[model samples]
Target: MVIFSVLYPATPGGRFDQAYYDDVHIPLVKEAFAATGLKDVQVFKGLSAPDGGPAPFVAMVHLAFEDAAAMQASLAGPRGAEVSGDIVNFSDITPIAQVSARD
Candidate 1:
């Protein structure tokens, strides 16, 4: 499986509406990518670092796909724009994305 992770950094003055992200954005993502081999979605909300400092990211989302091809196909399709464009509805921080293969 391939995991696509989107990480939102914690920045001063950044805005994040966790409630909207949880209630609206996630459902939108699931709906948009359901047919493109999307298997599961998981979200993580940051609390603090090991030293009790600000967390590096305010939130992170992991999208699991059957394979890299499926991921690419989904993102390259029309729904990708819809999902990506919805970011503004929740947070202003630009997300850092990474793809990883399960060990």
Candidate 2:
């Protein structure tokens, strides 16, 4: 399987309305990707940093697919466009994305 992971750092003085994200944005993304050939997805919030260090206050999102081609296909699909539209509402800063293969 292929995995896409993202780390989204919020802007300085950032304020996130969790209720909206959990209720609206998350569902929208799930539903949108459902239209595509979405295999699996995972979302997480930064609660604490390792070694008690300061965390980045990031939202970590992970998407799983059958392969790189499946991931690309989903991104190029119409539902991908819809999910992309909601990105701006989540964070003010750009995210870091990477792909990995299962061992």
Candidate 3:
């Protein structure tokens, strides 16, 4: 299995509006992600810093896939492109994406 994560740094004074994101954005992303082989999805908001520094990101997203190939395929697929657009509207900056597995 593989998990795709995205860390989105908030703008200088930006804060995420959970209500809108959960009610609108997430559903759109979920629909788009489903078309790109998404298995499960999780979203989180950073409340505080564990490292004694200001939290760099206001939001984080986790997406589970069957494997690395599946994650890659999904991101490169048309539906993924559509989903990516949602990110732009949701955040002040581009998100940092990473992948991990059982390894």
TM-scores for all predictions = 0.96, 0.81, 0.80
Judged by whole-model lDDT over C-alpha atoms, candidate 2 comes out at 0.73
Candidate 3 or 1, higher TM-score: 1
Candidate 2 regions with alpha-carbon error over 4 angstroms: none
Worst 10 residues of 3 by lDDT: 85-94
> Arrange candidates by lDDT, highest first: which order?
1, 3, 2
lDDT (10s digit) by residue, model 1, range 8-92: 9998999999999999999999999989989999999999999999898999999999999999988888899999999999999
lDDT of 2 at 96: 84
Candidate 3 residue-wise lDDT, 1-77, digit = tens: 79998887867866556677778888886777675578898999877688777776788888898887778888887
* Candidate 3 residue-pair clash tally: 0
Error of 1 at 33 (Å): 0.6
Give the worst 10-residue stretch by lDDT in candidate 1.
69-78
lDDT values, one for every candidate: 0.94, 0.73, 0.77
- Superposed Cα deviation of residue 38, candidate 2 (Å): 1.7
